[model samples]
Target: MSQSNLFIVMSIIAVISSQPVRGKDCVCELQNSESAFPESKLSRVEITALECIRNISSEKMTEVDRLVLGLQHRLQQLNENVSMLEKEDNGNLYGAVSLRIIQLELAEIQDLLDKLGTTNTNNQQLSTEMADQLRDMKYTIAELENFDHTMVVLKDQENQRIKRHLKLCEEELNATSPPPTPTMGNCGLGQMVNVSGAKTYSLTVYGTSYSFGAWGRDANPVPGDENKYWLVVLSSSNVFGHFVRQYNSLSTILLGIGPTDTHISSSNPTTNTIQGPNMVMYENALYYNCYNTLNVCKFNMTTRTVTNVALPNDAGFNNKFPFAHLASAYSHTDMDFAADESGVYVIYATTSNFGNVVISKVETSTPPVLSQTWSTTLHKKTVTNTFMVCGVLYATRYLDKDTEEIFYSFDTKTNTERYDWRIHIKKLQTNIKFLNYDPRDHLLYVYSDAYILTYEIMFR
Candidate 1:
């Protein structure tokens, strides 16, 4: 070979060698890869999550079946008791008691039916069975009506039904049933307030009542102000209004902490910055998630300066919503700020963990830093509202006009998860936007669509 040809060949070989070997775009052929390294890809969290999914499906079906059976049994017993009373000579005396029992059982069964209807049962067989049971309940209810209508009773007995039923109804209607009463404690109906049926009270601050949304209460009562609670309410004008309340009063009197209309500094620096739904109060600082930016804003009441901390990119802060979702929205439950016994934490849904909650502990630094994080099994879509009681996270789902079921709860202290707490809030209507429990006053405040409702928590 010629020297020129040899030199050209050597140069080409060196150039090709210097260039990296690029492979074709490889698809993730997991099945093929598993055949090579079967045990290398397994993850602990994934395994745990799979097991949890399996257990939840199994346990939910079992629970639905058990609830249906219990309701059926109770209905059967009530029917028998009512029939026996109708057959006796002194039936009217017992008739009232039997009818009362029947009425109570009917309420319980109805509530269970509501729950069964709302539960997302993917199993076809279980869903069919639930439908059948619901039909059976309706039949039972019809039979009860027939029996009441056709029962042969003396004229005195006729009045006896009304009188006894009225008495029983009166006893049930009374909201004074103390917490220790066995029939009422775990009945899921928390103690009823003595005030009007409406649980709402106006926020009277600055000698004038002002309506605002997205509120936060001091973790503990303001220092030196014993019974007085320090509360901050966010207005649509990017302003934070401060208020204080005495121990027994529902009225929120303005404390004049910052400007009457203290504006929060937004990155846009415009008059039309967005407002968020949730906020938490710790020490003398207020922490809230800003709407568009998805940043946690810490507004110091003392310094009157606002600091913003950016959440993780995947923080699922519903930036899609144009305006503030004060009452309710289809996807308004992206993030919520809750203060437990330990400290304040921001609970938000994230895309990274596949529909799970990420709780980040917020330290009250200049630019509040996320201290620690905990993953939760709860999917944000399933819950309507969430609040932290003590150190436990409680989630609610809207069932009906009067019932908000506590469907899921996670206790951070014991590291325990509960699916069916069966604890419920029984109120007049179901327009509650947000509910916060103030431990100091033992009061659960409800923010409905238009008004605010307050209820006293009676402890046994």
Candidate 2:
């Protein structure tokens, strides 16, 4: 790679490192089978196996990419180390087996990285080249592991472990490429770099400071209410709490403050508490993830009646800490609810299943049912937040300290995902706990800390 390209890659690493606000004890734990992520409990696909394939492809690709990039960076450091050692010993380190192994690893990384840049579905040649590289790397690692003749014990042990890890990643990646059928969706060519925004004043709420986790605007015009918008905010609690605030575009005052009520009583006492910080307003009803439970709650705006509909067992929930609301560390939302022109939908990521995005169309009745379910290749963790515009699912990525980019999109109409588009938004704050795109007003609501920012979307 050119020096300029290396500089760009390093800059991206720096940005990613700074974006996540962690405690001093937090460290980047290796994401292997023995790490934080459990072995993926991918479920069998009865209708279409597209999501499964995509899950395997995307996860393996990400793992291999990260490992290869790290290898390249380490190789550079090793080269410098080798040069210094040579200087100290009058060029005696040239014949070191550890140095030779490092050289071999660097060569393999260079080849794999080159393949990664040009490999695509359309190009059979590039695809074959990548597959060959993976196989070669796997073979090379096995060879290095068997040869146990190294003078530098520490370097040999580290390099061997790294090679073994890389081999495992490469082998996993090799199994997913060149699927049985043709690729259905392709990522966009470039980043959606153009974004502009303004901080529309924050609403001053009366009473003690409450840490609100979920916030959404009911953009669809209510029959009796014209130009009147309904904003719903939920505190970070599982037992029972919520507020419905009314807003008019002309006035800055938020008039109505809730029918502050508790309808969280459930037959399953263990799952009675609400575990979600995500809620969506559809028609006149408010839909939210019923936390610590495998269900979604639909609260009637007029009647104030709440009904619960059980989600599929695979639908994951992340309500670990009781009474944990809007805490930054516990910010990973397992399930999300969204509304669009067609109707309301529930979105979630699952570990028991394929670890892909599962979206279900909600049927608004006494007890709502999922009319239809849609699956996508995109994983849930990679996305920070998701919202629908004209039935299209756009997901945001927490890219950097100063930016949050729209890196992926799913066309619900065709059940395809485009990964290439990266629409960059310059952020005033580092952490964006909640984001909701109001299609009716063409405004993106970003909630971080005590501020609520509104950004106008102008696509060219």
Q: Point to the candidate with the largest lDDT.
A: 2
The TM-scores, one per candidate, come to: 0.48, 0.51
RMSD of each: 28.7, 28.9
Tens-digit per-residue lDDT, 70-166, candidate 1: 4555565457555645655663654565566568667866876776666544555555765665565566544444433234434567799899999
**lDDT to native, each model:** 0.55, 0.58
Q: Where is the poorest 10-residue window by lDDT in model 2?
A: 38-47
Task: List, residue by residue over 93-139, the lDDT tens digit for candidate 2.
Answer: 33464456457656766765665655434245645655665565566
Which ten residues in a row are the worst by lDDT in model 1? 244-253
Q: Stretches of candidate 2 above 4 Å error?
A: 1-194, 203-211, 232-240, 248-250, 253-274, 319-332
